[model samples]
Target: MIGDKPAPPVKKTRARRPKVKTGCKTCKLRGVKCDEAKPICRRCISTGRTCDGYGIWGGGGNAYGSVSRITNSSRSPSSLPLTTITTTTITTSTCTPGPLTSTRTLPPLLGATTQHEHRAFEYFFHRTSRKLPGIFDSPFWSTLVFQASACDPAVLHALIALGAVDLGKATRELACAAERVRGYERVALVQYNKAIVSLGVHFRRGGGDARRVALITCMLFICIELLRERFKTAKTHLGNGLKLLGEMRRGEGGRKRGGELVVNTELESVDDYLVEAFTRFNIHSSLFGQDNILLYTIAPHPSCADHAIPRAFTTFRIARLYLDTLINAIYNLAHQVASLSPASPIPKHYTNTQSHLRSSLDQWLKAFQTSLPTLTTHHPLIAPLVTPLLHTYYTMSTITLSTSLSPRDELIYDSHTAAFESMISLMRGVFETILSAHAPLGDEIPDPPGFTADMGFIPPLFFVVLKCRDRVVRREALELLDGAPHREGLWDGIMAGGVGRRVVEIEEGGSWGDEKGQGEVVVPG
Candidate 1:
């Protein structure tokens, strides 16, 4: 009876992992580890799986991967989900056969408190959204902010405030801060206060999507401050918004989708849009080489970076975006080296990064110059409007990369005389383009009277005059800068011109214009 070859000695096995009930529904269905990153999980994204978010909220977790709603006085225990394993799963949590589809839980727009509020909301939807975003045509302005305002009164109030105070003309005025407490500014101020109160109420009640609401409202707040030239306040808000976004990403293991948060649905990813908008604002701040600009580690050199450029860019928009990233990388590397090298020798890694950025920029120039005609194929306006603006930055990036390792040495800048000449030529082209646009050929002017979120000629011109000792080149750069209207992010063309003039006339002990002077004067090696 006991025969059977001793029953193969009873095969041994390891214990199975515990079933993750509190994990995202998608993870449960697929039998994979859920990083449980809020809104969406990292494991799902990296694996190309759609995170169906979490099941029903149990004892206050951020349900369905929305932002965890933290209260005014205290943090929600689940506000920051710092771990992959969750403690607050419904005991009866059920996973459906496929990804479950639930109606997004946004509230309908509430009634306007006043007729003025109603008018202001419509004004924003119709006019201000188009006007405010400028060249930085972000969906956050045109779409997501409006969507959030419809559901959150705080955002609604802020939107009304933003519409009431015209930002397109805000940067143009003088004594903006002193004048903001009266007249139409008073109307905007009232709405701004109301928005703050509404936001505070959400915190106290612990109801509605307070996090997304707060973030949207925060952008409005930043815009209001920036418009009024209250840059310090705007900077503070930008920092806070970025801080909150960092928390949300940390909750998601620092992974985010490309400006959309929802999965298997058309709902807006409020976090992605907000993050993008904030990041662009931060990146543009580097246009002036701001000391507080966020420093990033230089990427390792690509093996064939010079040959990496395509034969032609498919579209102007794609080309523009690619070039912007390269310039920003240069800005980031310069700042990082400046910050890091002072305390010690310039790291070899930074020097290597400088070479990589220089190589990429060289290829960018080659590709861009070759494809200049194709720039306006799809979007006819892009070439005339932004080509010159971008060229200046490309040249500025070259200068920055070359001098990044020797920031304080005035002598190092002399080597980049050709780069400064390139900026002068680019600025001349920009002026010519704008003048031709305003030629009044019985036709409407192209790109008139508006601000852009894109960094424009002001920064490059300012840098050229400051860095280039060739008086003739710097004078022309200053004049070109002075003639242009300023409305690009934090850069003011007139103000930059004044600063550049001061650097030449007062700081360098040089006469105005210094005309008929030798150009591109290179010192002996």
Candidate 2:
């Protein structure tokens, strides 16, 4: 084994031919490519968009890919995913997807419409919202479920930003959510059913959109009534009936429309109504206290201590109570703020009450602002979760006004006023944000009346008495007022609204349903 000098040139084996680098713009843009002998080629992608070679990019889409750029020159970003171009360079940590661009503009209300038309309108609107980029726009459960169904990193982060969900008020949000979803008719009942089931779980768990339930319930009812007027026919009637039935059932275990579940729960049952009303009554009553709770507070009085929340109030009743409190609280607070008498010494009770309530209000508002994604993503269903925040804000506003006047220290009062101003700004933002999101559907939903001094929840006849204002609002107000039993000062702070001549016209020789200067009724202006 003599190694001859330079062992006869051991030939180096030629390196395997380098695999042809098939240039793929799309793959390169996505930072990945196809697994083929050709590696990546033109047939693999057209117009610089990833073809996935096959439709592998089918059911589950590109999970964590960059924003999808439109290849078609004719189709503008406005028509597709990218709506507004970021001409102003935004230097940030990284670019993130935004809410989807909506294609369909708000439809003009056609006086009224048929059931089929209504469904079509809604579908079209939904499709428009779909085009908007973001997890909320996706059909898969949560935006975070992409590739893997783990909680969205974005969502989890958002939750932290928003603060923890209010465990104390979770049940209330869930109950109201169930009611909000019990409407819409389906082309395929099964699809609706499935939607409700999935939706119900979120709603029941108080996972999202629990606050806007009452407002939506009212909006939907108004929509349906208007639809009835547009198309008067047996089929239309049947469609309307089925839709209402679906709403009552809440899309659980129902027929399929276009392969989606259709929920057809009935909203008209005595039991359903009672449940809805009880939810509001209990919450409001607990906040206001024992003797004041009305209709469905659920607590047993001495005579009916054994009984639970009554099961007879309709969805209408529950909706009414929430709406009444919301409007009244806001108007009252606003008046209180505007009517700051410069001369009076600030009351201690008012200051303390404001401080306590303000903290709670701030906590609630901050939480809701953070939860917008979950609520917006789960619209028409989860949207109600935001409703309670509305009430909370109004309540806080009331406290802010009271506190502003309470602090005896001049410097403290100025500070309180500044804080109160900030709060008012936030409330206005909440209101505008909510209104802007849902293109003004039909007429602007009217502001519900505050409680009248009589304890009867009546819309003041002022709108009716005055000639120039909206008749529909006037009529609705009057109808609500018919239910009130006048109680003194009961509505003093609630209904002295700035709309017109004091809404409560004093009944000569009588107090509002109370003996003049006696009974619970407050004297009318």
Candidate 3:
């Protein structure tokens, strides 16, 4: 039976190919041809390796596995491989002109950073003029020659205008030309001097420009530095500078301007520009100081104008007149406060020392009243000086008030109070008159220098008067009605009301009131 079992029919076994799927992960990663299959692709199994399912498929780990699997896909199906693709085509812009236009060369001397070296290569302006008599010939031609030849007024004006900034550099030569000694050469020299001096006139009318002003200012101080005789000439230039600044301010409205003079745009009224210019001038003029040696010595006195050549007197002289007026006003205020001699005795008609103080006040007022018209006309800048002057008065008053007599004496207190009030009243009246006289008429320009000084001078004066009775006499001056400190309140009030600029225009016939004139106090003389 076992031998018969051996005769069982022999069985046949056949090899089956692996089935393919839609896409292979290895093919996707390597971007090569692959047969898509299920569990294991035919290509993977054919390599005699264990079939790891498509490595790039979602079921796999990160790209590392896929990248490793991609090696199997690199076997080429054809001799011409995909790597043979080359020779790219490119299009360029047509607008570029040429290499010369594109390339720029830097000189060996040129700086790699800030452009310092090319300074020598920069263009220069060389000036030439006729050699005038008695002075070394100027390398720069005078601007005046154009005007004298009756050349284009605009061109001459432009030259004169531009000349201001450079005036300092050329002032010595200008002064030399001005002082030319030969009588025969006088005509040309005179014309040249006129041209130089004309810069000032143009400056007054908003012509001599910024560069000229700077030069003139420099020359002014330089004259102080070098030639004593030239100081007057320098002063003249400076005065013209100041005057021109003032004119621009008045013309530009009330605003002040600075830097290179600019055209008045419609949006920014000329008057406003003028105001701004004037303000800058005020600040600048202050630097000259009340007593700069250059200004004081070189500045012409008012009487200097009487000379045959009135033009020779510098505008500084005019400015000095203003200064003199200020000094006089200060002196008078100080004298008024200090020279408060007691009355002889109580009169039957008058009550006490208060009455005598009033009489003295009236006398002061009368004198000031008589001079009011002339003061406003000549010293129109007085208003702006008031604050400093008032502050000065207050200081003087404090000293006088402190040293005068026993605080316990009612008569002493009364007399002091009366005197202070009367002085204050007189000052107020003076201010009122000033306002009336100088108020700008329709389309009329205020005298800019005077207006500047007046506008600037009032606020401090106002404060000096505000709490006088309390601050000096009353012990509780520090405490105000508000729980806040008195000083704080005063400052707050001033700030809320434009600080220094409030009360610019006093009401007509009312010292400190609105146009309707209510709440106005008639200051008792």
**TM-score leader:** 1
Tens-place lDDT digits, model 2, residues 1-525: 576576577788965543434333344334544343121134333343433221211111232222122111111222233322121111112222332232222122122333433333333222212321111112111111121111122221111111111111111234444322232222223232332344344446441122112212222222232222221231232233334433433433333333212211232212233233223322322222122112221121222212122232223223233333333333333334435675865456545544544453444344445545554453433244234334333443444344444333333333343333433344344344434544422221222221111111112222122221333343333333333322111122222232222332331222222321222333221
Among all candidates shown, the one with the greatest lDDT: 1
lDDT of 3 by residue, 1-525 (tens): 765657667787755444434445544444444565432345544553322333212112221111111110011122221211011111122232111110012122112412211111110011111111001111112112221112122223223222222222232233343432232133223323444564455446543343233333332232222222233444454555455544543454433223222222221222222322232223223222222211111111223111112221122222222232233223323333344446533234323333333343334334444544554454334433332343333433343334323323333333355444444454445445445544431221112211111112232234333333423322121111112111110122222123212232221133323322233222111
What are the per-residue Cα lDDT tens digits for candidate 1 across 73-161?
A: 11112232221112222121222112112222222344324444444444454445655555434556744564455445687778878
Sort by TM-score, best first: what order?
Answer: 1, 2, 3
Model 2 ranges off by over 4 Å: 1-190, 196-353, 356-396, 399-525
Question: Rank order by lDDT, top first?
Answer: 1, 2, 3
Q: Which 10 residues in a row give candidate 1 its minimum summed lDDT? A: 67-76
Candidate 3 TM-score over all chains jointly? 0.21
Query: Candidate 1: global Cα-lDDT?
Result: 0.57
- The CA lDDT of each predicted structure is 0.57, 0.29, 0.28
How many backbone clashes can be found in candidate 1? 2
| Model 3 CA deviation exceeding 4 Å by range | 1-212, 215-420, 430-457, 463-525
